[model samples]
Target: MINKNVFNKTKVSLIKINVAVVVSFFIIFSIFIYSYFKGLTYNSVDRNLNDELENITVQLTSSAIFSPIVLKDPSNMVYIYEGDRVKYYTRNGYFEDMLPKFRENKKNSFFTYTENGYTFRELSLEIGKYKIQIIRNIDAQINSFKQLIYVFVIGIIIAIIITYFIALYLTKKALIPIETAWNNQAKFVQDASHELRTPISIVSSKLESMLRSPNSTISDEVELIADAMKETRRIKKMINDLLCLTKEDSITTLNKEEVNIEQLINEISNDYLDIAEVQNKKFNINLNAENKIIITDKNKLRQLILIFIDNAFKYTNKNDIICINLTEEGRDIIISIEDSGIGIKDDEISNIFDRFFRSENVRSKDIDGSGIGLSIAKMLSTSLDIDISVKSKLNEFTKFNLIIHNK
Candidate 1:
């Protein structure tokens, strides 16, 4: 089962990632493009302001009379303050001569006025002691930048939304092969496991029966037959492990019904008790649940419980105890199986449910394990929408938890 902290998908969620990436990229790109064009527009406006100022300067410097003059025009209004003689001339007020306190502004200056709407440069010079000043409004450029910035921000938002769907479409196309490969791999493992089971079972059963028969046709054939049986058993054990590894959720859907959880556990406990007594082993059940009613597939759920009980009996030594606990953990129904004998190593516990995975330590001990018990349990739990997990410590205990959803 997947943790709640991280996002998980039974199938790949590539579309979500693709949508996020594309939208993020487009928003950043739109900002870059907007800034690029806006910067170009600002540069052009600045150049135009400079040219207007330069042209005014040229017209003023070319005048022959030393008298003040007003140059009236559509784009600009010029006023010449006849200095030293205290003469003043006013036109459209596009240009203004600085007072004597601002005499240094006769060279180059920047100023703003609310009426014309500009903070612009004033290029003025002394012409026969009459200061002629040139000025042009930069308000248009300022307004242009403000409006463009607002539009750019809005455009980026709209572009990001549009890019999300396009990214989803593209991601779906790219992930096709991955989906196919995953399905094929799962199908292959499932098929291979099914095909191998019958042969391995026949070999093991034949070997066991042969071992039981002390009196055979030929007396000399005992040692030879025993050796062959040993090899056959070993081969069978390996194949069982392979089959366990390949198991999958072949059970499609369940005819779900309201069953008493305690009753089911009790019935499985009774079956385990009989089997354990017959095998000269021991088993126990711990019922911690106050409630018993649960809606689920009775057969598959029973199979899962039985497999755990059987596995504990098979692996444990004679008279070893196998514990089964049915309880509630938060919203989930927690069913746990703890065995006293042959607990798995800490490192191997994680891979224990994997198809054909037996611990290296377990293999060294040469205990018979097809390794499919946990795998089948896992698949069955998955089909039933239950979560299964395990924890084991060497020589101490091994525990399996089947956590069923409340729904």
Candidate 2:
């Protein structure tokens, strides 16, 4: 089981990192957007001021009279100075008394002038002998910029809130697989320890029995020595199975090659025939597929089939029948291993592939198995993209079907 506190801490850490990245990105983006729009707004005002100054300069130079229409807009105030004396003047409403002082050195320059809580953009230009000054009120543009700043601040806050929730959801979703793997790994360690402890204890007890009778010769204590050695071999085999599982877990890719399905099954069947004859059990193989070649990891396929066949023999008694059938349906090649044995209960069928799982019947009968064989088979089938299914009835028959898709 996963510790709740640790899981929550992990989730919080991920969410914090995600939210921090989002906040940093949005802050930089907000600054860029504000700066760009602000410059654009102020540049529009400056361009307008320059245009008005040009028009006024052209009118004064080409004609003797100044056009009143040019100064009709009250937001703008214009002054023309000739040698420090006012040559021409137009007063804007409410800003008539706040005119800027003329400067001889300020030629073709733009500046901001503030007076009586009012702000203006002023442009000074020299037109021949006369100096022209144009001031435009920019209080409204400044207010609009302030509003834009407020909008950005509020937008960022809203974005942060939404992003926090989204990050929370995604982090939880991402941790599910990790949590499952953690629990599975913990269970696997516990089971492995339990399995190893039993045989080790038995071997220790057998050896202690032999030690207690030190005077007995080797021939007199042969049974105890044999039992100890048997348990030791069982321990060795279990450790090898565990290592196999670890190796399989670390394998990310498979070595696939052309494998002749018929030849492979025939070879496996030949080996099992000898075992069947010794055990007084009947063994048969039926290969019906027209196309027997498949692209797959051949070693893995062989190991997977051997597991089923070995299991079939383990649960069956003398004179029982074990059959291996190979057939084709559509693009799939089906290989089945069936036996007249003490079959699995319906409820336990789903759990047969779980690591260290043994059915109640097998446990009660004390059948020899480490319970890792089917789990390894399951892993191999998954890697080979083969589908395995079972049909069984308790105390009657058990059948395992492996469906290999032709690629």
Candidate 3:
């Protein structure tokens, strides 16, 4: 009972959820990898800064206390101290405030400091009558980490966008069958209602007319009663046909046996002979296969033949020829029913098997039919594993071919 709109919405929601989960996993994995490598890079830079500080301490210890340990590298900043007074230092003017406080609270041998929007890694060492402080600027490395974070954010955004579109495409493809079934079910309910409404209304109106004319004698009301009974019978038959269509799958339970194909055809042809005679039509039977046995569901097969013959009787004109032919083509048994009746239009032939479908020509005529017989036959054929096909030219002839695999 699912409607097309709700079915489509459910499909789209599921697709979105799946896309979100996959994209979230990818983003988390990417962030984990980036953070691991970034941590390694920072560790390497810290170790190198500490190693350079150790080398500078070794040089100062090897030299005299007042030997003036001059360093000209602009990237390296050094602070040389003797007791509580500064003996020599590099960039003292730039780090005057930061170095003084750092020297006073020299609790940790290595520490980090931020000054004037730049980060510095500081290492303090006590070297033979001198305390040396070495500083390395790490602003570039911090900026690189920030840039990496930005790149990951952008990549996640793009991935989400791509995943959304991909999910939309896949959901559309996956919902094709569900949407088709939903629409078909809706159409079926609508068609069934329309078909039942006419007969019920006719019967109700006929009975009401009889009720209003209570004093009318039985003879006067006979025609009205007959009309009501006829409509009631038509309604019953339509209901039976609907039930048969619905339970077409039960054909599989039919007691299958080796049935004589020629004899079955001959029997059906004889049964329709009188009906054809009343219409002045020629009903012909042709059995070309020498081997006439086929393993099949006999009762269901009889129903199929009756449906075709009845249709032939209804659609064909007086004196038109109707031929039923049974033949063998290799490993298959083919039963063909061709009628020279008022043939179906080429366009209408394809839809002849649809439920309650009648051709415009057939509808225009005063024919008594519920239009569900062919649909029932088609369903039965499907359940019995038989292939049914049709070919027709407007106003010439219409033919149906039923193929059964002869095992």
Best candidate, TM-score: 2
TM-score of each: 0.46, 0.90, 0.71
**What C-alpha lDDT do the candidate models reach, one value each?**
0.66, 0.87, 0.81
Candidate 3 off by > 4 Å: 1-26, 46-116, 120-137, 164-180, 215-222, 243-281, 290-303, 317-319, 380-385, 394-396
lDDT of 1: 0.66
User: Which of candidates 2 and 3 is the stronger one according to TM-score?
Assistant: 2
Q: In angstroms, how far off is 147's CA in candidate 3?
A: 2.1
Ranking by lDDT: 2, 3, 1
How would you encode candidate 2's per-residue C-alpha lDDT over 214-279 as one tens digit per residue? 899999989988988888998898898898888975432688999999999999889888899999
The superposed Cα distance between candidate 3 and the true structure at residue 216, in angstroms, equals: 5.3
Candidate 3 per-residue lDDT over residues 148-200, each given as its tens digit: 88888888888888888888888888887877777777777888888889889
Question: Which of candidates 1 and 3 is the stronger one according to TM-score?
Answer: 3
Worst 10 residues of 3 by lDDT: 92-101
How many residue pairs clash (N, CA or C atoms closer than 3 angstroms) in each of the candidate models, in the order given?
3, 0, 0
RMSD per model, one decimal: 14.0, 2.6, 5.4
Q: 1 or 3, which is superior by lDDT? A: 3
The lDDT of model 3 is 0.81
* Residue 48, model 2, lDDT: 85
Residue 25 miss distance in model 2 (angstroms)? 2.9
